[model samples]
Target: MINYICNKWKAIKRAKNILKNKNKIPPYLKKNSFEEELNYKLWSTKGARFSASHRNHTLNKLSSKSIGYLSAYLIIIGIVNLYDINLLGIKILNNQVGFISTAFSVLILLFSQLESSENFSLKSERYHNCSLDIAELYTRARFIKNFTINPITKQSELLQISIDYDAILKKYENHLPIDYLQFQLTKPEYFGLNFIKIKWIWLKYYIKVYAIYHILIFGPLLTLFYIAYLK
Candidate 1:
């Protein structure tokens, strides 16, 4: 029983040592070091890409909702103006309809102004470009790590990788901040699924966006037209 306990204690110590070693940063990657900078650039680029995607999706949803509501409000005003429409045999006055529609329109206009101020789509594209640049550098580094066998050749390759990393960073200096949720959402597994599944999932996402936007914007207009024609 003593031997068994000793063996278990030793095993636990070994496991802890392995974990500690794995978590330790190499001397070459110490603060302000070339390798550390390279790693930071890679991670920063990845985070910016993910944050931009999150922002893009959020702005798109907001824009769609605003447009949809604005269209519905406008259609209501148009129908009221053009036809003698009433709600359950009670006529709504033109002044009241105008006031309500104008209020909603003003609210939507304010919301739209806020959305336009951010210009998330343009930022998303910029981040995407930066990510591509960093990805190319990262791929080169990986290739060197994988293929270079001789110690001298490996050192030469690492030097080249550092140079390339610095050049890419200088060329694309702008970076976007990333939140934790965005970082998690944009991980490799998020978009690295099989090609068919990716296509199908994206297709469904786009379809849903389209359907909701069009239905909200056009549904009321179509209904108003149908009602006008019947009268």
Candidate 2:
């Protein structure tokens, strides 16, 4: 068992070339030469579509959050200006209330326009539905794989499904590489992602999704801390 685990770890290190070629295949992989192409298509596309679907949905949600945070910052600045406790407005912003408000307003406007143009909500729904269609084909293929004993008939049916897979992909946007990386993280048995790789992927996902917002939200706070205490 120890030896088995070690070999799995070693094989997992070469995971980048898992489906691209038949190199150091681990013991756990059950590759059916008959259904290899079909299986690979359905699985890979499904993962990509699902990952992209979630990513877009999160982006739509984040758009609202971006606006909300910026708006809140503006509101706080206004409220602070109404009183004498305007640390951000006084120290950080140099009490330029009019300019600050105008700049924030413009930023908000531009971002809202961008959010509308991107239409992440609609895109999220599209990828979600697309993923479902591909998942249906994948599940059907799995059923055939298990129950169908005749190699010839299975191959013929899977071939048709493979053709349909290409058509479906053509109808929708292909997911980014980052999306596929996220999917691989979700399937440990298949990808064998270790702790470091998983953390790296998680960091990449956060950066991809929320880096802008984090900078927007935290940048001011960090500056405030420096001026208020660290300085």
Candidate 3:
């Protein structure tokens, strides 16, 4: 058992921690074997699915917040117009606020439509459930490897797990390549990623997942502040 654990930590030197030490568990396979490939695929796919689920959750949150900001800005505009404040001259202020509020109303309407159409909350749930199913398959694979005695039976069980993995993929929308890359970053040891590579992975992931949301949520607020400053 000790040997198996040590070899497990050591033998996962291949890209994405390919299982080279079949002797520890299955005990009869060579390197670059089917078991190695299946192990990597199951682990990587599970990670990507979970990452995608989280990305969608963030998207939902940002969209909701954008709407809230627009609503608040509109209310502020309403309150400002109630008085005869003329920080930028009353006529100029009126024109600017009118244009800004009209634009904000359009944005709020568009964001509301997108909130329903994108249905990010539902997509997030689906991705999470898919990941959970994949995790179950991964556990079963590990169980078969560790405990099963008959090599032929073990191969059959692993193959079935692979098949189930395929079926699960077919049932759900495919995750983005960026999502898989995000997964790889999560397991730096598995992918043999260095410090710089890890940072690059995070950079790419944040750019892909959060960049647009930042623009959507923060851009308008910044613009509101800019307009206020101008006034």
Best by lDDT: 2
Candidate 2, residue 107: lDDT: 92
What is the TM-score of candidate 2?
A: 0.79
| After superposition, candidate 2 runs with Cα above 4 Å error | 1-34, 88-95
Superior candidate under TM-score, 1 versus 3:
3
Give the winner by TM-score: 2
- TM-score for each predicted model, relative to the true structure: 0.52, 0.79, 0.78
What's the distance in Å from true for residue 206, model 1?
A: 17
Taking the tens digit of each residue's C-alpha lDDT, what string does model 2 give over 48-105? 8888999999988888888888899888778766764757344534357767878989
The whole-model C-alpha lDDT of candidate 1 against the native structure comes to: 0.64
Q: Candidate 1, after superposition: displacement of residue 189 in Å? A: 10
Model 1 segments beyond 4 Å from truth?
A: 1-44, 47-51, 61-65, 81-92, 166-180, 186-231
Clashing pairs in 3: none
Total residue pair clashes for candidate 3 = 0
Ranked by TM-score, the better of candidates 2 and 3 is 2
lDDT of 1 at 22: 61
Tens digits of per-residue lDDT for model 1, 19-50: 88764654335565654566555665657665
Residues 115-219 of candidate 3 have per-residue lDDT tens digits of: 789888999999999999999999998888799999999989998999999999999999899888888877777566799998998898889777876887677
